[model samples]
Target: MGNCCVAGASSDMATFKWSIDNFSSLLDKGEGWTNSRVFKIMGHAWHLKLNPMDRNSCDEECVSLRLQLSKTSVEPNTIVDASFRLIIYDQLYGKDSEHHVSHTFQTASTSSGKSCMIKLAALKNSSGFLVNNNCVFGVKFIKVVTTKAKTTSEKLFVKNASTLPEAKAAYTWCIADFFGMENPGYSPEFTAGGYKWSIRLDKEENHISLYLKKMINDLPEDSAVLVEFTLSIKNQEGGKHLKKKGLTQFSNNDPTWGWEKVVSMEDIQDSSNGYLIKTKCCIEAEVTTVGSSKMK
Candidate 1:
């Protein structure tokens, strides 16, 4: 059982748009502002605020727009580094109005935008902006910095194996009380590549975390083992088995490597999924030691 895919970090831009119909009706509602349906960008919830009339006395002839981060979505004191563009589409003609902002949003600076987005007279002029009582607005997120920082240990694990060994071994562990099992359940030690190895499962709140651990003791300092492996949970009733693959180095200082969420507990608990049958389940690991070395 050596199976799982290599994992890494990624950062990509994201976008969102909002459209409103009956544009003229919003002005008659007497409400100073209205909000768009909530949407998400990289897991953070946000929404657009459209004010029919500008908030400032000097900009009364213009409409204002703002991008607001959802209070319930972000934690207190958390900071979000963001860059985005706000757009007001010209429905009839193709001339769109745009505004761009790059700022770190926090507790006090959760909203950002332009106070004078478009002139009320020009928007209602029956030209490009408002057509057939319809209007459109959009936001494109240029960046959203995540809080989690990748660790040096993960970098050491993703390196490609210098050489490949045809040798590989697979082992399976069966559990009697699947859900009732304590935090970590270890598989019997199995031999692979002249080293004893075992599978470890920690029952987390939402996932069954999996890890491949070396079970040997040695004297060599600065020693490391290059391994390629896959960890999986079998579907007892003939369903597709959940599996993941990984390639990493196992050293004296770091004897284990695997995913924090190999398979979710939700999938394991569903009876029809066949992951658990009569309170019993199976876990497997396929391991291969491509190479190993010791510091000179």
Candidate 2:
């Protein structure tokens, strides 16, 4: 029978060469190949076997594996679907263990890829999955995987504003301060819109607090007042560029008073160290004149 031999060096034994050739006629005779040929085949299968003589040797020989998706430029807060497959080949047994892992991609809100908004699922070994120092890892070799990129929109409450008519009774406007619970501030210019206002207090010392006061006077009862603004929180020291979404709801007792509950602010962003806050507010009120004094 016609035969062709393919020759190459073993992966670990560059000094030694080997070959594979068709040998159907010899196999049909119920006879094995020569011993030298068998040895060469064995060498081809396992060119190198790790050896550990001590703890240090074991550490040095231990194989650490990782898999990563091709890098792409993504916009902030954009959601992407990603999936991957990995094959762990145990050379000693000449067998492969298959693993599947997947994640939805979200642009880093802070610290480039340091944190992801999507929750990762489909891991074969739970303990092997880690998000240490912004590095994501999977065990063994990665192969035959697929990912779909998708974009999703999330609604974030920015802030609150209040507009009152010329005649005002008690112009009670609710504004939520979501500026990094630690360093809340009123901007120098009300560029955000709808009001010429002053901050009652810069920061809330303890629990989130809000106080109500009359901004204007004509002594009217229940004047229509509109409140609107944006809520924001600073990212980690180096992640100041990530944009965060904010939401606010009116507190129960004081409809005109707004304060974010601590628990609700948990997932605002993947923050290394910082406080999250919400924008709270109330609906507009109708005005009625109470005192007979026109001071304007």
Candidate 3:
């Protein structure tokens, strides 16, 4: 009897060639695989089987191959310097896989405050063996630079108005003394021209409108004055009482000085009431105090 030629030997060789051709095609289509495809094998020593192709089968096979590739291809968090080379290889076969996809890239270098790009290239043999067979791919990089640290300045306060005797006394004793101990960042200085202090204030509507002027040592030209006037009621018997003394009044009708009108007092408390009150007066001064550092 004449010896029978193996049924799959020729076809298997042809299929292998086809697989290589498909891989070459991938390299030509760009640097990477467009998508992965999978297949099943069922051919033992004697028993025969048929493999089918479908969406589910393809997805399962592709995912498995990709997982294998990812595990063996690259290390996580690999710090690459500028202009360094990379090499990717198919783990399934020691030889370059049938897919000509690039397995390596070069990282570009950049300056402290600039950006950089990475380039990729396909694997190839020096011999004319794989030339013109879609065995290589390449990519270009544009900008490459290192990251930079941001720079900022500390808070600075500027003087806004000339210092007066009363204003200076109030600031030195009440504001300066109080804040100097509590907040050392605040810089309070006095010179022949005037006393000046610095405070950090952000750009907020409430801060700008209400607190800004009061915190600084200057007032606007058309600014109205605000003052806190306290009335002390003492009886001849040496006891002080608000109910017996009744209400204290200061108004524009006063002979000594009269610019503001104390309309009324609704809530009355008999307590010490030694509160530093604030009222609008004709004379106004800008007050400023250093705030906390914005960066920290």
Runs in model 1 deviating more than 4 A are 1-167
- Over 4 Å off, model 3: 1-24, 27-83, 86-287, 294-296
For model 1, the local distance difference test gives 0.75
Error of 3 at 240 (Å): 50
lDDT (Cα, tens digit) per residue for candidate 2, span 1-296: 22122233333212211221232232334422222111122111112111111112223211122222222423454444433333333323434344454554444421111111112221212233221211122122122222344444333333222332444332323445454333543322221122233333234333333322223332233322323322233333434422222222222222232334322333433354333223432212223222121112
Give the per-residue lDDT digits (tens) of candidate 3, residues 55-84.
122232110011012222223433212221
Clashes of 3: 28
Runs in model 2 with CA error above 4 Å? 1-62, 72-79, 109-296
Candidate order, lDDT descending: 1, 2, 3
lDDT of 1 at 242: 86
Worst ten in a row by lDDT for model 1: 1-10
Better of 1 and 3 by TM-score: 1
Q: Candidate 3 — worst ten consecutive residues by lDDT sum? A: 44-53
Residue-level lDDT tens digits of model 1 in 1-108 = 011111111346566667777878887775476777777776688887888766456645677888888887666657788887777878766778988878676777
Best by TM-score: 1
